[model samples]
Target: MLGRIAPNLLIRIAGRTTEAGIPPFVDLLRIAELSGNLPATDPSSTPAALLTRFPHLAEVTFEDVVVPGPHGPVRARTYRPPHPNGIGLVWVHGGAFIGGDLDRADAHWPSLEFAHRGIRVVSLDYRHAVRGVHYPVPSDDVLAGWRWAASHARELGVAPGALHLGGSSIGGNLAAGVAKRLRDSRPGTDTIPAGLVLVTPFLHPFGAPWPTGMLERMRAATTNAVVSPEDLTHMAWNYAGRRSVLDDPYAFPANGDLTGLPPTLVITEEIDTIRTSGEDFAERLRAADVPAVVRMTPGAAHSSMSRPAEPTAQVTLDAVAEHLLGRWSPRAA
Candidate 1:
C-alpha cells in the first residue's frame, strides 16, 4: 500500500519527522504508507479551473484529446495559441516515474507558456510506473501521442520537422528513450523529433557522480537539494521492476549510445543532486557529435519548474521558450 506522494511534497516536508517515528527523509517515493493526512496526487483540472489559476490563458484554446496508445486510450491536453508559430512540442511532465498527472504544474504551466509563445503543445498524461506498471508502458504512450501529432501536423498547424520532444525529471527519461526508439525503428526516416528538451532530468540509474567538492557545496546550500544515490537507485529499480531493465538503453538513455539523437537542451537546477546526470548527458551528446547545450537555473531546486509564480521558475521556462523559438527562426528571435 504505497501512498501517493504529491509532486514536491518531499521538499515541503524535508527535515520533518512523521508521528509514526520514521526518520525524516527527503525521498518522496520511499515514504511509508500512512493512514491519514497524506498528500494525494491532483486530478486533471477542467478548463475553468485552469483559467482560474491562469487568467492570461483565457485566449489560448485548450482541447482534451484521446490518443490511441498501445496499452489503451491515452488522455492528452492540447494548448493552442491565439497565433500559431508553426512549431509544436509534445511534452511530458515529471514525478519521479510514479506521481503526477496532467494537472501537475510541470505539465500544464509549461504547456500554457509554450502555447502562449505560439508553439502548439500537446501534454501527455502518460501512465506512471506504479501499481504494477513498469518500464516501456509510459514511453509507449508518449510514442503513440507523437505519431498521432506527426500524422496530423497539418490540421494541428504544426510545421513538418518543427515538432520537438521534451520532458522534466523521469518524464525526460521517457522522452529521451522514445526519441532513441524512433531513431532505431525508422533508421533513415524523418519521423524523429527535430530537437529535445530535458529539464532537471534524472537520466542514470544511480545518478551521475558529482564534481569534486560539489556534494559538500550542495548540502551547504539546502538539504532539500540533496537526493541520495540510494534513492536514485531505488527509483530506477522501481520503474524497471527488474535489474535487467536498468541496462536496457531504451529504459535509461544514459546507458545507451546517443550518436544519432537530435539536438538537445539540458536544463539543470543549480543546487540539485541530480544536476550532474543532465549535465553529463549533455557532454555525452556533444562527444557523440550531437548539438547539446546545458543551462543551470540559478538559486533553484529540483522540481522548481512546478512553481510557475517563482522568479527562478519563470527564468527557467523563459530560457526553454527562447530555445524553441530560436531554433525555429534564428533571425526573428
Candidate 2:
C-alpha cells in the first residue's frame, strides 16, 4: 500500500512535503506519528507504556519470579502463551553488558510474539557489568534461567527438549556465552537450547573492540569521558574485566568452537555495527553444520529490533516463531 502512493503523498497525508534531498526516513516518521503508540522515549521503568501504546496486541501474560543464578538470585519475567508451548526462548535483554532490565524497549516484542506463536520466552534480568557486577555474572545468570525453564517445562507447557536460548545485541552475545556454558556443563544430553537466535550479537569483543570509529561514537553517547579514544578501549576491557576476561564468551565468543552448538537463526540489521560479527558467526557455525540460517535485513540499522516497527525486526521474529512452531512453510530460503 505504501508503494502505491506517490512520494508526494506525504504532503497530502502528513501535511509535510518531502522537499529537496530529504532522507527516506520522513515517511517512517510520519507513520510512527500516525501510529502514536510506539515505544515511549523512556522504556526502562515504563513498560505499561507499550501496553497503552499498542492495545491491539493480545495473547500474552507476564509473570514475575525469582530464579537462582550461578552467582546468586536474579529476577525474571516469563512470557506465557495463550495456547500450549512447544518451544521456549530464554532471552537476555540488550544493553551493551551495562544497562537494560526486562522492561526496556527491546524485550517488549518477543514476549508478545513468542506467546502468540505458542512459544515461551523467559526474559532474564541478568546481573550486569555495571554497578560492580560483570562477565560470568550475566552469562551464568542466563544459564541458570535455562535450567529453571527446563526443570519447570511441564509447568510452563513445553516439552523437555524444545527450549531454546537467544537474545539481541549484548543479549545475543550473552546467549552465546550461555550456549558455551550449557554445552560444557551438560554433556551427553540436549539440556542446551534446541537452537539459538543471535541478533547482531557482539561475539568478538577482544582483539577487535569495534574498530575505533562509529561504535566508539555510540559508546561515547552512552558514557561520558576521560575524553581519550584509548579510554573507551580500556572501558571495554575493564567492563569485560582484566582477569579471565578472555574466558568470558560475552567478550570473545570466537574463542569457543561452534561445532555442535545447535540449529541456529541469526538476525542482523543492515547498518548495525555488529552485522559483520553476526554474519561471521553464522558462516562459521554453518561450516560446522550447525544448521545456521542468517537474515540480513535491507535498510535496517543497528538495534532495529529495539525501537519502532521495522520490517527487519518484524520479519525476523516471524521467521523465528515459524521455525519454532514447525510452520516454516515459506518458499525455501
Q: Estimate each model's TM-score.
A: 0.85, 0.75
Query: What overall lDDT, based on C-alpha atoms, would model 1 receive against the true structure?
Result: 0.79
lDDT of 1 at 99: 67
Residue-level lDDT of model 2, residues 55-104, one tens digit each, is 54455788899998768898889887777557777888776565567777
Across 1-333, the per-residue lDDT of candidate 1 in tens digits comes to 233554455435444543322223323443422321224333334334557767887778788899998999988998899999899999998877766777778888889878988999989878777667888888899889888888878788999889999998888898899899998895655388988999998888888997787766776775454665666787788888898999999889999799989999888999788999999999999889888888899988786777665568888898889899985432221
For each candidate, what is the lDDT?
Answer: 0.79, 0.66
Error of 2 at 326 (Å): 3.0
User: Candidate 2, which segments miss by more than 4 Å at Cα?
Assistant: 1-46, 186-190, 206-235, 247-251, 309-311, 329-333
Model 2: lowest-lDDT 10 consecutive positions:
223-232
